[model samples]
Target: MGSVGVAELRRSLDGLLTYLEPHWDFVNCHMVNYLTDDHWQHFVPEPLRLELNTAKDLNQAIDTLFWRSNRQSQQFPAFASFLAAGDHLRLENYEKLLTTVEQLEQQLATSTHTQLSIKEFMSAKKCHEVELTAALIDKLVQSKSTPNSTSFIVDAGDGKGYLSSRLALQYGHRVLGIDANTTNTENALSRNRKLQRAWNGLTERAELQSQGIIPARRGKKSNQQDASIIPPSLENYKTTSRFITTELNLSDLLTEHFDQQSNNICLTGLHTCGNLASTCLQVFHAQDNCRILCNVGCCYHLLREHFSQQEFFGNKALMDQQVDCGFPLSCYLQERKVRLGRNARMLAAQSIERTLAAKELPNITLYYRALLELLVCRHAPHLKNELQVGKVKKFDSFPEYVKKCADKLNVPWLATVEEEELLLLLEKHEIDRQYLELFYLLRMSFAPVLESVILLDRLLYLKELGYEHSYLIDLFDAVISPRHYAIVAIKQ
Candidate 1:
């Protein structure tokens, strides 16, 4: 009916709602298609286009929400440019976008003041075990089939026992935090000592506050002490404990601490790498007394061999003989190119200045390899063999970079024609710098989904093991920390 600018259009559309739309055809066609192509690619299959063509009232509602009256006659393009984004519009993945944006904005705001503070870049949640321990305690308290007071927590692959300390000090729960790193176990003990001192101060302060000796807020007038001096539940208190061992020996360590016949124990982890989470799942299933488990798996590829199902390096096997892998490095690289293309525009504006600041531009291949590394964990392995085994000069241009790569791989010099041929291929793939900015939003949307698959595996494993209340919840910012989802399970 009328023209609406990008600003108004964004205000009207909720991104996440668009994702969760119940009408499969509407979502998969109109919204999903527009996203992949920015409504520009006419090459879209007729079946796909027809899917969006709803003639009923349901179709009308979908069209009004997305196409809108203002966009009624703009002759939307059939193909989108790379990373076709439509602002921060009514996307189905709104909550994640909001959280990541909030954290990033806050971090950016404080950046100028703290040039060297990595903590500013960290998420709002505790990097250590305090938050997780609190969550576990809440779950335990709510369970009708709560285990005996002697029940313990097994922190599998526990690096520095962050959660272990919280469980012991706050909830008064005994915990055994295990890890392969000797230094990590030692540091955990050291940190727990420091945590213990700090906790003592907090307890004393809490007591005073409870007795009306202190104020809850800064400079607030108060007649009585604040209740925060003594948190009603150890829910706020933190614990400290440590146990160190290798992956192969974890099962033995768990068996030593937990009795299979009588003890009611819970196995848990936070960001346990590669096969560590898998090991936890196996241990949970194998141990009868280990009744409740909460695990969040990471490093899907490293769990085991996809086909042969070779046990690369874990005590327990979690994967089937076949690895359910998707998205070869090719798709990830394409998406990344789409992302970097937008960022390159900003760099293009300050190209001279940035080039000067760095004192050298990286070789084109090196830059390409770095971007590709972000998509898939592996890097281009042949480049090093092909290029001169020497330190790369920052001043090298794209051609110079290619020449180095060719020389390192022992290939003959690339003619200008050959170089251009390669560059053209990159452009065709939309791997150029122009697509980076917009693709970040889409990438942000996928972060949670990617992580969900990993976390879901752990929940499913727990469920299959007879722990019915096992659930995966969004406990932290998905964008700010894609690995922020938590796997929480209750003992029945």
Candidate 2:
């Protein structure tokens, strides 16, 4: 889809609000205000509050932050982290702001009184789990009754192969685990092999019982034994059956396998980053054997939004082709239009843990957010050489980190006007931080709905292609694996 200019996009935003207002109202009536109780207190109800607070002034915030006609002249960052306007915001001011924010983050990270909130994270996981499982079971049932086809379980972007191994051992289905990360691919294969060996022993023992060599226990039934249960110690499969391949290229491996056997294949992925999941979807569409597809994808921007099939993967139907994103990308763009705002409250809590661990001041969070905003504007991905977060080597001080970033971004020093300008920008932006935070929180609250849209799209796609026995089911703990939706499309 062509990029809609800010003015036209604002109109589209209004249309979306008009559509979502009723849904917002429904939430307000049924589920909005449960923050008082400890069980529900994890959700701050900030978004609902924003909906109420901005009911009269929503357009004002939009106009101030995102709706200016001049905004169309400047390019926004393709990645979420780099969505700020670097040139418009002076480099010195940006650097100081980032520096200050980093110091604040360091302080936060090294605080003594910090305690992480598991409830908030757990709630988000719980919400996603419900939606994911529903979609998987729905697809599996629809695809079950068809004849003369094997059920091929294909896990794309299979990190460490936890889910893939479980599916293979417990479900008795042949699985193909694909990943771009070689280490992760190797780990997954290793885990699957371990699980496979453990499964083989169970199979052998079951065979022995079937021959009456071993008596069936009183409490345990034959069906229970028949059900594949992986032993904790995977010593048995070390010398026996192997469940998956080790670190093979997905396109080459799948092309060869599918060419030989085309009737039975189901594609799945969990948290496939950027273009990888998109590639999986394209592969599924192109391969005639890929009868069922269940993918829970994250990292939206990595998806080549405007690319045609030929431009990206040399396939035509996988191109955009007037497909409704199903995702509220326009609405998300509207959300971004608000201001230099982010929902790092969860990160804030995590920062608390880091602070306590590091014994540094808690204010490092401010620096991190500030730098993140600057990075968003700068549109630079992979901060390995410059700014680092989440378990990195020690920096002597906040200034040292700033110097590293400044050196990398090619700026010498901060000017007085830049400092003043950056602080002023922060003050101006902070006025609407409450609203932005609310919007972010609200967006997160709707993650289940968002995932549901993706799941439903795949389900409908399969149904449209005449797969009548598709099913979807809850595969595992959503907290442990947020991408817990399992799609089972079978042809018997």
Candidate 3:
């Protein structure tokens, strides 16, 4: 699959879009609309309906759609088949990429990259993301076509400099971590300083232990803990706080940190958010010095679709440019003027495997929200705006929930609605709750398919530009880092 180039990705992207176009409403629609909207059933074929009805358990039916092959004709054939198309989007055939630290101390490759687990520094998932990304960035740097090209990393949306810090401190790369938020930049710098001191102290302690001077503590093995952090020589790990707009220049930004003569940059962003991922690609594409790109994107809901039915989020003037605002980057979809709405993008961000493995049921919050909508309709019809009951926890009863919502919305009339009435409303809509959960699972099954559309669009964009070395490497473990696909492109 490493040899599989633009032609294959273009073909894959086209096919995925073809299936998704007509079924867009099915894959993208909200779970809250389950009972209200009669249209979801229209998307499910007759065969699927028959199978869903005959299932031993509704959740088991979901497992059949999500975990196993959807091609089975035994039951839920149509729905299962629909899900199978999504499974194809998993990048099962792509090349697995690994990087080796080539410096003298790292001469002998003793092992596959050791997992970094630093407490107080980050979550286990975050630790996995940073380590894996640094190694891949190492590969991208060494793999550069120009052997003499001095590699510097421009970390786009480098929130708290986790990846930037690792690359700069451990890998000895000159990293310029950029972020939209000023506070993040300041915090990252502060955090980097503390981490450096910790590493400095650990290095001394480990050296003493190795010299057979400092005795090892019993029941407290620190060698395993020490391996993750290297002796920190924080080499100019800098941050520039700014929003990554489409017009941002890499060459100009690099000149600010390095000498004006500096060139040969590798643009990398860990979990580049919303339109920023697309922004990173555009920056990589536009800048001559940006010879390599490794981007793992997240926050799909924040992406502004070029062809979306919803309002585009961000500066309207930015949208006026030729860029697609991260949607339908492929020429095939561009020709058809394809658009994925915000809701659709949000739905795409969900993880079916993680959700099912962890047994994450639909939050009762949905049930509360739906019932509140009904209450709004019956009692406060004049209230034009929707009431947002944010994160109500440990309520004794449904009436208490209503009172709190009423108080928040400043709707005194809700007090008049009795607890008996609220219970009756729950009684009336009890079946809707079950239906919502079932449909939520159905919607979740399309998660990977929708994400594939977004990722493949980016991959095809590189191919469209005539770069052949580009590949989508499933970089991190999905259970650890949900946004695991890294778009690696090298210009020949």
Off by over 4 Å in 2: 1-148, 194-262, 275-285, 307-404, 407-410, 414-492
Residue range 144-164, candidate 2, lDDT tens digits: 424765455677766766545
> For every model shown, what is its TM-score relative to the native structure?
0.48, 0.42, 0.83
Model 3 C-alpha lDDT per residue in residues 292-340, reported as the tens digit of each score: 8989899888777767754644455544542446777767668878787
Per-residue lDDT tens digits for candidate 1, residues 294-358, read: 66544544433222222222324433322332111122222322111211212211222123233
Quality of model 2 by C-alpha lDDT = 0.39
- Give me the displacement of residue 158 in model 2, in angstroms: 2.6
Q: Is candidate 1 or candidate 3 better by lDDT?
A: 3
State which candidate has the highest TM-score. Answer: 3
